[model samples]
Target: MATPLAALAADSAGDVAHLIETALTPVFMLSGVGTLLNLLNTRSARVADQIEKASDLLDTEQDKEAKRKLRHHLRRLTRRIMVLDISIMFGGLAGAMTCGAAFVLFLGSVRDASIALWLVALFGAALLSTVAALAAFLCDCFFSWDNLRKSGPLPKSVKKRSPESSASTTG
Candidate 1:
């Protein structure tokens, strides 16, 4: 077995930075996609709510049919938001894995220098960015669920909740 000290050796600073840069790619791509989806969903939900409200003034069969279609579209959008949330979270995991592999490689090459310090800083920043992406994903998931719940009817049990009610009292 390779000793721990031997495993940490690196040959060059450029090599370590290359590893870090490679790890950063997937992290930024995944998180950027997630953020864009979140923005799109939020804008869509707002437009949907406005349309729904305006639709109440409409009384024709044609009007009702159009509203129904709009509602269906909104439901689909909500599901898409949820899926994006999940995808982003998985992407963050992938980013972490890539960064870990690069770090391990850096350590094994053992050519420690200013490049080593730069790689360490880069690794830390990448980890932080991945974590932020995870947080955004979770927030978006909750937002999607809340929007979906509000856009439709609630079960009687949920409807009956008093202002002071708690989950224990209901569930």
Candidate 2:
């Protein structure tokens, strides 16, 4: 009888170990979602800065053409900010769902409950949310890249030139 009891304990321990091993993948996924959220936040800050600069220029600029350009930039910045915000939200959702899945897995294992359906549903929700977040991020990247390409090279003020007085000395 003691031998049978020991075997039962060993089997239970093995099940717990397996449950922990299975949970590890979702933990790693949570880490990945955190990384993506950080990147989205950084990009959002940059967009906010650009929006501030554009708003400032709009207030002071008298030239019609320049004002129009500034307005366009502001519009683009606003759109980019919205997209990034959505991406961050989705990423957060994914992380939360993954956490819930991990918790459910542990609970089910301890209670000896059949939670396979719940596990699958939670994991599937996490995966779909992650996919949506990534897609939004990709769209934001395209918007940023297109704007940079359209803006062309940096303005003349950023370019270095030889001083007029120094130019004569070279001869």
Candidate 3:
């Protein structure tokens, strides 16, 4: 007759396989959240760069009207960064909750305990957080679009990047 350990070993393979299947959904969601976070961070960085340029222009600008315009642009850019920050925060929260849900699921499987409630709660919260992040991103898009339309074609005090500029090198 097989020992208890041997029987457990025989049964564990199917249990582990089921756990992996159940865990895949959260992993996919986490990947999407990571992608969104990447987008938000990149947009925030670009906006920050614009803010720095605008600040420099505001300092050196002699015309009253130009200074006013620079200040306005700076305000809009700041608002964009704020919205992006919100998106980033929510995206990060979603990612964390997704990871937590995965952990709970794994723990439940290993311990032979029912973690369905906790998993559902965490996954649901993650979904909500993802929705919130997307909403913030959409708001930022609207703001950016309106700002662009009002500002017209020319970008004041912002230079185009060209090859050989060598302003900042990337590996």
What is the clash count for each candidate, in the order shown?
Answer: 9, 0, 0
Candidate 1 weakest lDDT stretch, 10 residues: 153-162
Error of 3 at 91 (Å): 0.4
How does residue 143 of candidate 3 score in lDDT?
Answer: 91
User: Which scores better on lDDT, 1 or 2?
Assistant: 2
- Report the candidate with higher lDDT, 2 versus 3: 3
Candidate 1 structure quality by residue, lDDT tens digits, 27-102: 5654664565466456546645644544442322244455565555445555545555554555555456545646
Q: Which ten residues in a row have the lowest lDDT in candidate 2?
A: 152-161
Q: Rank the candidates by TM-score, best first.
A: 3, 2, 1
Give me the candidate number with maximum TM-score: 3
List model 3 lDDT by residue over 1-171, tens digit each: 665456457877887577568889899999999999999999999889989988998887777787888999988999999999999999999999999999998787667678989999999999999999999999999999999899952246544455666555643
Residues 1-171 of candidate 2 have per-residue lDDT tens digits of: 345346447687777577568879789989998998899898899889878877876877767777777778888889999999999999999999999889888787666678899989998899999999999999998988898799742111212345974687776
Estimate candidate 1's alpha-carbon lDDT, on a 0 to 1 scale.
Answer: 0.53
Clashes of 3: 0
User: All candidates' TM-scores?
Assistant: 0.37, 0.80, 0.82
Query: Mind sharing the TM-score for model 2?
Result: 0.80
- Model 2 regions lying over 4 Å from their true place: 1-8, 12-17, 153-171
Ranking by lDDT, best first?
3, 2, 1
